[model samples]
Target: MQAVWKLSKYIKPYILFAIIAPVMMVIEVSMDLLQPTILQHIIDDGIAQTDTSYIVKMFGLMIATSVIGLIGGIGCSIYASRTAVNFSTDLRQDLYETITYFSNSSKDKFTLGKLVTNLTSDMEMLQRALTMLLKVFVRGPMMFIGAIVIVFITARELFPILLVVVPILAFCMYYFTALSGKLFHKVQKVVDMVNTKVQENLAGIRVIKAYNRKNHQIEQFTEVNTQLMKRSMAADQIIGVLAPLTMFVVNLGIVAALWMGAIKVDNNTLQVGVILAFINYLMMVMQGLMSSSMVLVQLARAIPSAGRIVEVLEENTDLTSPLKPEIKQIQGSISFENVSFSYLKETESVLKNISFHVNAGETVGIIGMTGSGKSTLVKMIPRLFDPDSGSVKIDGVPIGSYSLEHLRQSIGFSPQKATLFSKTIADNLRYGKSDATSEDIVQALQSANAKEFVDKLDAGTEHLLTQGATNLSGGQKQRLAMARSFIRKPSILILDDVTSAVDSISEKTIQRAIEEQFSDATKVIVSSKISSIRHADQILVMDDGKIAAQGTHEQLLQESILYQEMAKTQAEKGVTLSE
Candidate 1:
């Protein structure tokens, strides 16, 4: 209910339609109730006494009223559907906006599959609930109550049967609702598991095929499908029992009404017209109750779905910009003062008490074995994760004190894994600057040594890349990713082993381009190959999440044993070091 309440702000405008549709429903129901009275009059006053003209007039009036009611019902339905769709659209948009604000720490709490399910399947459930509630929830009860009133007016003696019948039917509805609520919650969980399994299988089809694990993958999917089927069957079984139980009670009430009404008519206490009207009212009441039961079943399904959406909406983001953060321009100087971090506090730190500085326009290189926290260290520069105990400063101000948007805009990052979207080359390069000209894109591609390959292609800059850039080779993808960062023209550029995919020639080409094209920008390069960072003005060797040595290449070769061993290993492997 809280989730619905929070969404009410977005949905409130359409609530006027909710109100209008129900009123129109009541009008239609009123017309239906009036038809039974008209029939009673036709039988008693017009036809019984042999007045043929009055009977014809009454019949024509009934037909006209029926037509009016039908038109009103149709209009109400159209209005309700339009409003419901717009309400759903607004709800989906809000959910997307909320998710976009989630920090990395908050995002880890949900899987991609589960989020997708919540946004689509869960929201659909809520939309169905809203549409049904507007169309039927109000009308069902109105018809039930109105029919009872009419039954009392036409034949008071048969009305007591409703007291006995209504409670029994209500109790059946209550019991089924309680059981179905629990079952539907389980159904949603099973659905999430199925979605997760399918998503994983599709995304990793290459690995599954390479290992020839088709049978294994099929078995895994079948398990989840079976679980979903079992839960759905259980819910259906509950509904199956409840539906017949309600019908049995309704049938018993009808038998009682007829038997009692017949005695009254024979005893001259009631006329045939009255008895017929009473029976008509009873059927209307039963139908209204049955429709109400269906609404309850749908509500049971939607409540849990709404709860899941609320959980994500209520999550707290660990990394939020300060209320009044500094908004100054970045000058490329960065400092880490005893910074330490861990993904989890109980585990060993991914980055230990590390301290370093890069003055304006300086090139600093970081080299370490895998798991030495090279990527983790650079991630903090953009505040991807806040340091545990110390401050990271940009331009002598603590990074946390800077606005998140301002800080990120000032630094260009190329991740260890080069990710590209399914778009044309021009679109991908222009991602850094939406208004970038073709010349800007050409220059960026040239700087990354990607211009030659891009120009040779049939479509050139307009060539469409497949998802994850699967159409391109590893080196081509890396170079394009590097071009994306280069076009940003940021004050600080952090490349996290981005050149590892390319050969030495291409690697040197990109390095030379960075040095010459952006002479004023400070660069931090993280690499595994010693040759990649040997020409850096200063190099830092990291071991076990801490810096083991820091100096120029020649100084490190002479002073650091680790650097010397790394250089010797590369020499023996026939990899030449940059002078």
Candidate 2:
């Protein structure tokens, strides 16, 4: 209910259509209820009088009223659909935008599959609920009450049967619905599991095939698919029971009504026409109750989805910008002051008391083993994760003081994973600068050593890359990612092992290009290869989340035992390092 209440904001824009839909539904219900009364008049007045002209007139009137009812139903459906569409579309758009602003903590809160479910399946269920609220929800109660009113007017003696039967029916409805409601949340959770399995399988299909795990993936999917079916059936089983339970109760009332009415007819106290109308009213009441239960069943299923959506909507963003942010002009200087961080709040820190400072336009290199927090250190500069203890300042201003947009725009960061979108080469490059000219793109490509291969392609800059840039070679993808950063021409550039997959020749080409083309920009490079950082202005060797050594190439080789061992190991492998 809270989720529905939160969703009501979306209905405000489409209020006219929302209002019109229910009014039209009421008109339809009223018209349908009037038919039983008209039938009574026709049977009692026209047929009983043996007047053919009167019977014909009554039939014509019935058809005309029936046509009007049909029109009202059609209007109701059309308008309800309009409101539902607008509501779902707006809510989905807003949900997606809300997800985009999620911080590191918020990202950790929901899995990709669950997030996808909330945006798609959950929103869809709420939309269906909205339509039901207008059509079945509004129509059912009105039909029930209207039927009761008609029976009271036409055959007051028969009303006692309803008193006996309605309670029994209501009890059945409550029992079944309560049992079904228990399974709704379980169904949604199982659906999330299925989605997660499918997502993992599709994304890792290459690895699955390489390892001959197709059978294993199939078995995994089967388990989740079976679980979903079992839970869905458990929930629907109660609704299935409600149908026959209500029918039995309503039919019993009909039999009782006929028995009593026949006794009255024999005594000349009741007409057959009135008795017929009374039985019809009882059946209508049964239908109304059944229809309402079906809507409630849908409501049961949608409630969990609503709650999940509300969970997402109400989640607090872990990272928030200050009300008054400083917008300073930056000069590429960088510093880390006693900074410490961990992915989890109470866990062991990944970067411990890290502190460093580099003047404007200086190129600093970070070299370390796999788990030494090399990537995590440079990430602080862009404020990807705020340090737990100390401040990371850019141009002497704490990075947090700047707006997220300005802070990110000031730095060009090429992450470890060289992600590329499914778009033309030119379009992907323009992500750095939406209005980048052809000359700007060409310069960036050449700087990243990607120009020669790109020119060889048939479309040149217009060549299309598939998702993850799977169509391109590892070297090509890395070069393209580097090119994207170069396109920005930012004051600060952080390349986190962006050239690891490239060949030695290409690696040297990239290293040389960055040193030459981006000399004015402060360059921070995190790599495992000593050759990649040996010529850097300053090399910081990290070991176990701490800076083990920092010095120039010659000074580090002489004084740092770690640097000596690394250089010795590379020499034994006969690997070339830049002199």
TM-score of each: 0.94, 0.95
57-117: candidate 1 lDDT, tens digit per residue? 9999999889988977886787778778898898888788888887666666787678888
Span of ten consecutive residues with least summed lDDT in model 2: 318-327
**Best candidate, lDDT:** 2
Residue 193, candidate 2: Cα error in Å is 1.6
Stretches of candidate 1 above 4 Å error? none
Please give the lDDT score for candidate 2. Answer: 0.88
Candidate 2 Cα errors over 4 Å, as ranges: none
The candidate maximizing TM-score is 2
Where is model 1 poorest over a 10-residue stretch in terms of lDDT?
2-11
